[model samples]
Target: SRVSLVVVLCLFAFCSAEYFEEEEEFYPPSRFPIDPDANRTMCEIIQAKGYPCEEHYATTPDGYILGMFRMPQPNNVGPPVLLQHGLLDSSFTWVLNYPEQSFPYILHDLGYDVWLGNNRGNTYSKNHTTLSIHSKEFWQFSWDQMAEFDFPTQIQYALSKNAMYPKLVYIGHSEGTTQAFAGLSLNSSIADMLYGYVGLGPVISVTHMSNLWLRDLLELGVEWIWNVLGIYQFLPTPVELHSEFVWACAECPICCNEVIELICGRHHGAFNNSRMNVMSGHEPGGTSTQNIHHWAQMVKNPTFQKMDFGAKRNEEIYGQTTPPVYNLNNLPKSLPMMLYSGSHDELADPDDVQTLVTTLEGIVESVYWKEVRKYAHLDFAWALDAVDEIYIEVTDIMRDWVEGI
Candidate 1:
């Protein structure tokens, strides 16, 4: 009897262990193939498009083969406008809802090729020639790397492909604008290649008014967990275990309710759950392992300068501890640039944009701060109603600028 009991116990233990192992394997350790059906409303609009969007690869100086999307202009006439997406989002985020809106599509119709860039560490740009995604080298990059390496390579590649053009215009949103400034400031030669620059909801300052509570929670949570795990670095992509943890907290019943309350206090009463769902992507998107480190630098030292790692590293590469802060004081005295803002955009408040404008050395030949009475940050890209008004003004500006050039 004792011998039989022992055998049965051993069999039960083996079965339990096997079941757990299979369960773990079923949910691939990565976060790819995110649930495309969770937020049906948002996915309905995003997935409606059947456009032929192809992915192109470019290698950085560091040999990172970054992923980019080439949305060919319908007629292919004007200079290609490099479309830089915001933090944590891949190029697909730019055209995910293309069929419903015509901003990007209109640009295509107007003969402007749109080359959307995906920054390092995003899902699309996940491979590197020398570094493995699991290594610290992969996570070493930040927005600084994007400005110094990614943008220059992408621009040169774009201009090389379209050799007929001497200059190209730029449209960057959020951190995209930050990197644009960093690129121009570090390599003035690239500045000569730009016909005009348009920054939408630019993130020059880290002192955000909206989304304060959520941002705080994220920073605190990351700091605590990373410290506990003895992980001093950022995750390479949002598929890792850490990324999952952060997302769970952000979307937790209590945390999400608190976030809604905060947004409501900001007078954004109609906070669409679908928008939040979409912004987070099919899974929790944009939680780079190195993101918190870079963000720490940005928030701790609120300056429009290149990352403040110290003069030695900066000088070795960028020639200064602080890359010139888009020396608004040095902008071509007559350069025509446009700065647009949303009234309810807490990230890039109207005051902040105005302050940035004032820093420009030249009198901005034209300025249009779209105080879309109720528009917020995400709405600049996702709001169905705001796109028409935005595209009309944007395309008109581009037409005038291109004509002048």
Candidate 2:
């Protein structure tokens, strides 16, 4: 009887620890079979997955053609929300994880009309009226142009389509937040139309950032690198480079995780590791070197403001010795805003977020502080449990605001 009991216990332990075959079947949709080429357009990917998606094109005042995607509601009976992607990322960021977990999809499932913005110079928004992609003029823009031109154009376009919705909700990540702040600063009238703004990993002041190497690089200056390498586009992913990285990530997932950990913050297993290959296709999508230089300028500068163009040029541009700061205090107190930030985000450090919070108390509404402990920067998009830990709460808050609850 004792021998039989021992054998039964051993068999139970083995069975409980499922083998690779069984575990593989349970991996999330982000795991494998992601076609980078086929999924280039947001509509294509969403339609492929049995969701309704529509592509809308908007022309910036500066003549750049920006692409925005819409997941139209079934009966036009939902609040409109516009989501913008971060630096070197496209609209695809929102839909990287499983449909149930993705923010855009969740918003759609919750009866929100969702729109995704693609900024100028990304893979989707690469075309301009007269300027060729190879011309230096095409690569001359920074987040400033994105704010003054792209943001307003896209917002107006979305507003035009969804006329019934008064005052659209704006949600932005990383550089997206920067553009909104800049746009609103330049034209506070824009704030009059926004019902509320939700910022994820809002990056404004990076002078006190935690990334030491990046900080050092900023201090030293990044303009010289562009000149030395003759690089017009910063970190442009050639088709070969994209494919190679994707293939490497797929074949050696552990190595890929280590690389991300070394560059980004400690993962703490927050990100869905298997989806790195899927993410690689869209990341480092494309950006002008000038834009990166602008960020470097932000890091080196003491205040949250416009890009510095040296004393002489600054005098010419701003009629001052130094580039005047964007007046954060100028924002309307009635314009509702909320910020979502992670504690471990190296780029948008918690301290920097605190600075923003302290500075922007006038227009601040509700804030969802770091719910997931030790969540890093990219985890906002890639964290496997983000739906449960982050999105659900965000949706609840936005729902209340939409319903006037």
Candidate 3:
């Protein structure tokens, strides 16, 4: 019964990572202290981990309030780094591992002010100023809305609070990376506010996607499934029901690992299943069904354009024959970008990443690119060796940027 589950869910569960000199070598699950904060908020979990934490909120122009967690600088006001998680994930994604191995904590220990963003509709950011979350209109948005609203609002909020840091560094994984790409392209002013951009599993369009099960589902028509399943908010009901589904996975570690492999890719050796009992509690964070449908459209159609409404709806909504494409070429010519991709990532195919990089060639200032041959989509977030493999690379760049200023 270990069939692929991305057919139904587990599709966009995605991104994250590192830094330091001869720090205490903290290995996970064995040497690591277990996570008992499964039922806790990200701020509570961070506080319990003995870190100073603050909860911040930003209201997007569309009325949704995004919740963010900040790990303040220990002593001096170090450079600010804002992190965005991928589809169906929350800020909790960066804290699933041990302190030394976890990206947020490692950066915190390195004296960086870390800001974790929860995308709209995730566990933390579910509130809208005027709409009840139960209304279908509240769930009408996809990542299209996220790019247009969430990033700008969150980044501006962070910048507004901290006057010392003129511009914060931006880092994203999977769809996190996609939103930044789309956001920066659609609004060139985003580059003026960013010191640099780091994309852990930079996804544009999944041209050579390897998940056949997911691909087949997209091919079958998400609209048909949306109608058949009656899904508006993902999981029909949103938070409580989604939490129960994750609870089932947390209680069944073996099955959870199987699903991780199916959705993330075939590479599982790097995954840390020892603490899945805790991590799985936040595994499938939450998103709109329309978001997943939009992702399906990405797979079905080869373009990385805005979410496709059917031709008639497109005409009504966009005043066009088809949806408008996100202008990747419009990205600022001087935006320094760091891009990393895993060859084994099922969702972020190597070829697709290359296509994205090719489009970024003359648009961005400089690109630092690397591919991890064995890493799957989740490894960037949960792999045991990510600190050594990915985090150090990111931290090294951040260090240079901080020093130059």
Candidate 4:
């Protein structure tokens, strides 16, 4: 009888375990490519339209194979636009929010071939040839390595295949803007290839922003946990966390509800709750959960290039006690660069945008500091009522620049 009871207990435990496992599998936490079917559908539709969208792999100098989407221009257009996404975002981030009216679709409509770039460490760009992501060596890279290596590789490969001029027009958002500046400043070869530069919600400095309280708390938590785990520098995976904030955000509407409330309360003063809901969804757009961790690293350690190791290392790098501010001296004195900013962007203040523009060496022929009086950072992409205004302005600016070229 005892032996029979033991067997029954084991069977019951196994069945329970299998049941939970099946339940978890049925409901995946929200992450990028939110709907795989939606992503596959979009890819299929793009291909069916005859533009030839293919998955292209770009190997970083460090031998990381970054997944990229190549949308060839119709009739082999010259000098394709290299579209780089912001932090915690993949190329799909561009297409997800404005499935019918985003920049990529609009640019494609305007006869410009678009190639979307996904930097290393994102979900799609996580493979490495020589190093494991589980190791510190993989996480050692920052925006410095991206500008110096990844951007150049993508541009070179694009140019080689098109048989067009190597220099291409560049468009980026947020960290995308920062990487563009770093790339142009450090790699003059690539800089010269850029026909014109466009930045959306550009972030040069965040000394004015004050939305970092939650980030500060999270960083402190991560540091303490890492020390406890005997892992000093490596990032922790979502699966090993105390809370499933990432997963919750994916599967639970309550998480999105809280995020919308927090963001709206902190930034969007007097904005409609319905509009706020739409904006919060658009801020993250279609970024994956893992990408969010990579962004946390940048927020914790914001440097134009890489982390600074204090006075001695600064002296070694810049030949001075204080490290030079990212060597902005190399930025083209007369390059036509366009910076767009929202007035209420706490993260990327319009004032700071102006400061960045003024600090640049030469007279930027055209500077449109659109004070979308009611505009916030999230609004740039999400404002259901304001996208047309934003799109028209951007299209006009690009059209003028193209005409000049």
Per-residue alpha-carbon lDDT of model 4 for 1-405, expressed as tens digits?
A: 244333422322332221122123434544532322232433553565445676788887779888778777656774477788765455755654443446666677777667888777764676789987556556556666667777788777666666655567788877678778877787665756667787877875665554553254334444344334433222211222212333344455455555433432233422233222222232332222222334444455544444444689768866777534566667765567776777777667676677787766244454455556656665554455444656666667666655322
Pairs that collide, model 4:
30-250, 167-193
Question: lDDT for each of the candidates?
Answer: 0.58, 0.73, 0.77, 0.57
Error of 4 at 16 (Å): 26
lDDT (tens digit, per residue) of candidate 1 on 1-405 = 244333422322332121122123323243323334333332243334543354578999988888776665444445777877776555555554444463566566667766777778766777899887656567676787888798878777766666557677788877788787777666667777777787777777665545453355344544445445434333222232323433443354345333323422242323334334333433222434456456555655557665555678878867766644545443443445666677877666767676766665344455455556666565555556645647667778878767522
Best-performing candidate as measured by TM-score = 3
lDDT of 3 by residue, 1-405 (tens): 124554345333221101123444343232333346765667777888888899999999989999999998755387788999987778888998778788999888888788999888887888999998767788888999899999888899888777678788998988899899889889989888888999988888876888776566576665566555445555321233334434555556677677656655665436666677576666666778788788878886788798888899999989997999998888988888999999788889989989888878867779889998788888888888998898988888888777532
Residue pairs with colliding backbones in model 2 are none
TM-score of each: 0.72, 0.85, 0.88, 0.72
Query: What's the candidate order when arranged by decreasing lDDT?
Result: 3, 2, 1, 4
Q: TM-score ranking from best to worst?
A: 3, 2, 1, 4
lDDT of 3 at 255: 74
lDDT (tens digit, per residue) of candidate 2 on 124-235: 8888888987777888888988888988888888888876777678989888999999898888888767878888888888877675545554655656755565556654
Pairs of colliding residues, candidate 3: none
Candidate 4: C-alpha RMSD after superposition: 9.8
Q: Which pairs of residues clash in candidate 1, taking residues 3 or more apart in a chain or in different chains?
A: 88-286, 234-289, 234-290, 235-289, 328-361
After superposition on all CA atoms, what RMSD does each candidate show versus the true structure? 10.3, 11.8, 7.8, 9.8
